[model samples]
Target: MTSFARKVANLLGVAEDRLERLAGGDLSEVLLLRRPDGRCTVAKGGAGIGTEAAMLRSLAGAGAPVPMVEGEHDGVLLLEHVENDELFSPLAWADIGAALRRLHERRGETYGWPVDHRLGTVELDNRQRSDWPGFWAEQRLVATASILDRPWRERVEAVARRMAELVPPDPPPAFLHGDLWSGNILVAGGKLAALIDPACYYGHGEVDLAMLTLFGSPPPEFWEAYGPLEPGWEERRPIYQLFPALVHLRLFGAGYAAMVERLLDQSSRNLSTTE
Candidate 1:
């Protein structure tokens, strides 16, 4: 076993019988550790592990399904192993939609999180603001401008300036799973098992929906279970999507530049039509 794994085992006061590495994102290393008593725990080590633990606790407090945090020491976060077959059936999608709806029902006094977070090397600005557009414009859209090329930066700035006209000035500040992609969702037996690896905050709930649809479309069952959305969500989807696209572009390089451009084009077209 690696020293890190041994450290986590010692911290948890468990005898590690076996340790198996699990697939994880660039930001963290994930391992499944089995104890002598046949109990399994997941140990994660990397930047923001403590922040993730806090996010999970917040989710639990808000009645969302998340893995129980066993312990955290140094940079390693230990959590109860959640069983998953990684299957997302139609019913599972509906279940996820319903779960997200229930989560979003819990509102915050303002937009943004109490504390900021990071995704890989990118820093998420979570400074609270009374106006939704101002928060999204400064914190989400324009924050990455320095890392982007001139043309792309200009495009992003244009959209950022039009935030108030494009997005509702005030929507209920619903709790958001800031990163709600399919990969973060774990499923078991055709049902939603848990929503893991959240970059959570309070913002427009549509932000989660937009992120959910960024890489792929959820089935009709999802929308049905999620209930109705405010009008203009279709137009705002690209605007909301731009933040993640920009993050990917910055993290993964030029491969994602096209995605950012595509979203910018869509948002620009929507703005022109409205004008």
Candidate 2:
């Protein structure tokens, strides 16, 4: 911990005896600190940690449960420490799906935040257009293409330009957990308890469901629970899933590169054959 870390601790009212460091991501360091009264706070210190802090604050009490943000210190943030270990079970999947459905059901005119925000490491601008296809093409696929390798970039661009016609314009837009992979959800007592790391925006509800299914659908129960609001989703699931594959390719490395390329090629073939 550095002077900056200490200052952040002071801001959270936690003293030396109370603080214990928790492993954090590459950019931030997290400390779980107990106060004199035994109350606990999760202090996160680093640059850009503020986005998650701000998002949690803005989306607080939007109906679903999440860590209640207490304070944001210059480059750090304090949140009510959720005291559960990582969700590591099959049942946890169902609970998370149910919780996600509840969140997606949240009604709003426009999905993205009014101001600029980051989705984990990626910058998000849901402020563009309410048109989901346009957003995916311009902001998501195209915006990230600059960093992708040449062959992969061209393939993604080709698929993206025609994505408007491939992805149907049905299923009225619902709030999406933009990045709802298995990792971002939290579970406790065998129940999905909270949502974290939102890249929230509005789009076809299937986008969230499709993402959940991307890394292998959470579990049978999860799909069953979500099936009511979203029935018969398999038809377009493959198409919707391309977004996450592309995201992984960009974020991780060449390992995901092949996966993205494969999906893009398949999508192009499917579109072309149909035409």
lDDT of 2: 0.68
> Compared to the true structure, candidate 1 yields what TM-score?
0.94
Superposed Cα deviation of residue 231, candidate 1 (Å)? 1.1
Clash counts per candidate, in order, are 0, 1
lDDT of candidate 1 over 152-223, digit per residue (tens): 778889889988887999999999889999989989998888889999999999999999999999999999
Candidate 1: RMSD to truth: 1.8
When summed lDDT is taken over every stretch of 10 residues in candidate 1, the lowest stretch is: 9-18
Candidate with the greatest lDDT versus the true structure: 1
